[model samples]
Structure formats: C-alpha cells, structure tokens
Target: MEEKSWSELLAEHSPELAQISRADGEFLDADSALPAWVKQLMAMQMDAVFNHPHGARWYGRRARELGASREQVVEAIKLLRIFGGRPAMATGAEGLREPSE
Candidate 1:
C-alpha cells in the first residue's frame, strides 16, 4: 500500500479537508491572549485522545514549536483510553518522551 499526501487523500475521499482544516485553524487561532503552547497542546490532547495519527503528529510538531515540554506532551497522550487513542496514543507517548537536549 502507498501513502497519500493530504491533498491527494482529500481529492479522492475527503474533499472537505481544506474547509475543515481552515475551520480548525480558525478555532485554534481565536484569541490572542492565550499562549501558543497552550493552544497547540490542547489541540494535541484532542488529537491524541481521538487517535488521529497524522493529526497527532502534526499537533506534536506544532506543540513542540510552541514550547510544549515532554512531560506536558505525555500528559496529553495519557488523556486517551486504551483503544480510543490507538496507534496515535502509543506513538505520541513514545515520540514525545524523547529527551529534548
């Protein structure tokens, strides 16, 4: 099996990807007062619990960029039920636990 770019996947299956991504970005970008790390980490937590592998990874990078600590990211992964998070919870926990320095 081959992997598809988001654009390719959306074109073949989820044509609404752009709109959904835009909407989600708007929601996450809403208030100026909230710290970037907070918003990214919150989104990561949702992605972790929901078992969105690509989305979780995407959130992980964003959270890292915004200064999410390893411990904080782990806490986010722990939000998932065993099955609910699936590959994402496991993968996120493993990846986020890596030493920063």
Candidate 2:
C-alpha cells in the first residue's frame, strides 16, 4: 500500500491550511545561497530541537540524500545539545538511527 504524504494527511484534515503549508514549503525549498543539503540539515535541527521527531527524521533523510556527511549530522546534533540541551540531542540522535535498528 502506498503511504500518504505529510501534506496529503494535512489536506485530509484541512485543505486550505494544507495548501498554505505546501506554498510555504515550495517557497522555503527554492534555490538560494545555501545548498539544498544545508537547508535540509537546518530543518532537521529545528525539528529535533522543537520535539518533532518525525519531521527531524524526514529532514535528516533528505539532508543525507543531498550529500550531507554523517559527521555533519553529528556536528549538528552536538550544536543542538549546546543550544537546545540533552533532550534535543537525544531526540535528534534517535532520528539518525537506521530503520532496521
């Protein structure tokens, strides 16, 4: 079975809000001075710090796909620990775990 996307799930509950979210995502995803991987990594950090594990995992995967190194991801998590404390670091680490584990 096909899985529903985040936007698709959002759309089921609130179409207008989903549209706005999609537009916002498109705008944020536009090409900029920062590379795609950097943007995705930033998003991953924010999600992890904010306690959105699912979003953190999603963004972390995207960042890796875009060429972010494991070291880079670890450094980001360390930064989170410094700024966002241990809980954030723990959550972010969880997001980095392999699915099989």
Candidate 3:
C-alpha cells in the first residue's frame, strides 16, 4: 500500500483505526486523537526523511503543512542527531533553515 499522510490516513480510517489491524506496516493508532500526537508524528517523519541528501527539500514544507511547527521540526532533528550522531544532526539541521529568497 502507498504511504499516506497522517491526516489522510486518519481521515481514511477513523473508527476503524481505533482497532488494531493485523495488517503489517506503519499504521497510526486510532487512539491518536490528540492534535499534538499528529503533529509530533509528522515532525518525526522529518527525522526519517532527513537522512536523505535533500530530505528538507522533500519533507520540510509538508511537515509544516501537516501541523509541525519549526521548533518541533528542529527539536525532532536534534533528538535524531543525539541518537543518530553527527551526520544526522548535520542533515537534519538543514530542515530548520528558511528557504532562500
């Protein structure tokens, strides 16, 4: 199955999401009713994608649009760097920079 945005995934599966399906892959719990949970999820996505060379260009705008603040995005990067080390920190930090004018 295609990877869907958290918002799209949530909308596509609301009441059903509350139940844990045996189907494999990353499925968000229906219990993620809190707005922050959704935001944090999106921010963490940046952490994963930031491993790519151009991950910020790939996931930065979408992350914010998905409700992740700049601070949250940066914080997620910092966390990843702490665990993932320098290279992760370097790439992830790029996500925090505002696009050039």
Candidate 4:
C-alpha cells in the first residue's frame, strides 16, 4: 500500500542491483548477464547521453585527457548507455555515425 519509484521497482526485480557495483571502476557485469531488454535500453540511453552538446564536449575532453581516441569515447558511450532525455533507439543509433571532435 505504498508508492515507489521505477528505480525501486528495478531494485526489487533486477538481480543486477545485488551484483552491480555502485562505485566507480567497479565491474558492472562480471559473471552475470543482463536481460536483453535492459541491455537494449542501456544502449539507447548511452547513445542519447553521448550525442548532446555537453555530452560530446565532456566526452571529448575526457578522451583527450586520457589519451584515448574519440572512437573509444563513442564506444564507451554506447557501453555505458546513460542519456539526458529518454532518447529513442533510432536517435541513439544516429549518434553512432556522428563525427567526434
């Protein structure tokens, strides 16, 4: 008889909550596997996050600081899958082709 957020629901339902690290440099999916849909959503979100003006700037800067390639930043974006807005998969897909700075 109580209201809960989507994150709470996910925490209750997803096994990843118990396994995935909440800290930096922690392995997210070491031995466990993610559901197909969750993986898809993460991919979409990551694309949306990386394609924004701020996102691109931050990513480029970080990549440069780390001596990594823009392509690596782009790939990391896809792998991380966190976006500002709930970007549609198609938009995220479009981001994949976007030229990096």
Candidate 5:
C-alpha cells in the first residue's frame, strides 16, 4: 500500500482540524528572535521529551535543513535526557539516522 501524505491523512480525518493546525503552525513560524533552525531544534527537543519520536525526527530533519549541525542536534538530545531520561534520548537519536530519500 502507498503511504498517504500528511495533508491527505488530515483531510480524511478532519479538514477543520487540519486547517487549525496549519494556522497554528503559521503563527508559530512567524518572525522571532530565534532563528528558524533554533525553533526547529526546540520543537525537536520538546517532542522528544514528550515521547513523540516521529515529531522529534521530523523537527530534527527540518532543523538540519535550516542549517543546524548534527552536533547541535546531539546536544539538544543530551540536554533533554535530564527531563526525559534514557528512553527519550534513545528515541530522539532516531532523528540522527538517515531517512530513505
């Protein structure tokens, strides 16, 4: 079976919810003192700490694309270990693994 795009899945579930999510994303993505990459890294850390591995990976990849270094990502994961413990650190590390292109 083919994988469904995020929009497609959201549409199938709830278009209104998807629209709200997009709006919230746009609001959060607005200009700020922090750079885009920093924001992505912050999101990754929060996701990892919350046990949201998929979000952690996605934000980590986005952070890299926005000019964050691997070392930066690793550091963020390490910092989160205090709050999230070993399991969270392990899950966050999944972002380090290359995803299939």
Candidate 6:
C-alpha cells in the first residue's frame, strides 16, 4: 500500500481528525488511537523547524526540552494551527494534533 499524505488522511477522516485534534475529552488518549504514520509525520515536521531562521535556535532548544525533534516541533506548529490556532488551520491538517490547553 502507498502512504497517504497528512492532508489526505485528514480529508478522509475529517470528523475523527477533528475529534483527535480538539483534545476534547475524547482526544486525550490519541497517542494510542492515532495512526503511527501521523505520529511519524508530526515528528518529521518538528525536526524541520531548525532550518528556520528567526526562532530556529529557540525552537531547537525547546524541541530538545520537549523531547521532539526540531522537525516534529515545526510539524506541531502546523498541527497546532489546524487543531485550533488561526487562519493557517487549513494548511496543515495532515499532522494536526489537538492542541493542549
């Protein structure tokens, strides 16, 4: 089988995706519930942030603290938006993680 893009997965399972992204009472256990591919994509995105300039270092340091790769953090930034951030929401639904309050 071929791998699906994050967006593809999100579109296919939008409601379930929303539930997981919302971190609602039901989303808290997402780690076990979400697909492993989504987790991997999230991790990859976190690592990619180190490539950025402005807050790259700060993000890198924070990524270390969070135990997520810089790419994963980057990915989380996107995901956070999709789950509940701002207008950027539509852009990164693939690896979206329901933001934690």
Q: For model 3, what is the alpha-carbon lDDT of residue 70?
A: 78
Clash count of each predicted structure: 0, 0, 0, 2, 0, 14
Query: lDDT tens string, model 3, 15-90?
Result: 3663333221223322245554354454455546555435444455555655767787677667666666777679
TM-score of each: 0.50, 0.66, 0.37, 0.25, 0.64, 0.24
The full ranking of all candidates by lDDT, starting with the best, is 2, 5, 1, 3, 6, 4
Q: Which ten residues in a row have the lowest lDDT in candidate 3?
A: 22-31
Measured by lDDT, the strongest candidate is 2
Shift in Å, residue 5, candidate 5: 4.5
Residue by residue across 2-86, what tens digits does model 2's lDDT show? Answer: 9998788999999999999988676546557887788888899899878899999988888788788999989888887787776
- Could you give me the TM-score of model 4 versus the true structure? 0.25
Q: What is the C-alpha RMSD of each candidate to the true structure, in Å?
A: 12.0, 10.7, 12.8, 12.9, 11.6, 18.5
Q: Looking at model 5, report the run of 10 residues with the lowest lDDT sum.
A: 23-32
lDDT of 1 by residue, 1-101 (tens): 89987767765786688678768787675556886767887777677666687778887788777777888777766654444557766777787675873
**Candidate 2: regions farther than 4 A off:** 1-6, 86-101
Candidate order by decreasing TM-score: 2, 5, 1, 3, 4, 6
Cα-based lDDT for every prediction: 0.72, 0.84, 0.55, 0.48, 0.83, 0.51
Off by over 4 Å in 3: 1-50, 86-101
Off by over 4 Å in 4: 1-52, 80-101
Q: 1-101, model 6: which lDDT tens digit per residue?
A: 99996656775779677556555423322446664434544444444533444334444454455455656656676775554445444556645756661
* Candidate 1, poorest ten consecutive residues by summed lDDT: 76-85
lDDT of 5 at 32: 70
Tens-digit lDDT track for model 5 on 2-76? 999887889789999889878866654654788778888889989877889999999999888878899999998
Question: Runs in model 6 with CA error above 4 Å?
Answer: 1-60, 85-101
Best by TM-score: 2
Model 5 lDDT on a 0 to 1 scale = 0.83
Candidate 1 Cα outliers beyond 4 Å, as residue runs: 1-4, 7-20, 26-31, 79-101
User: Where does the lowest 10-residue lDDT sum fall in candidate 2?
Assistant: 23-32
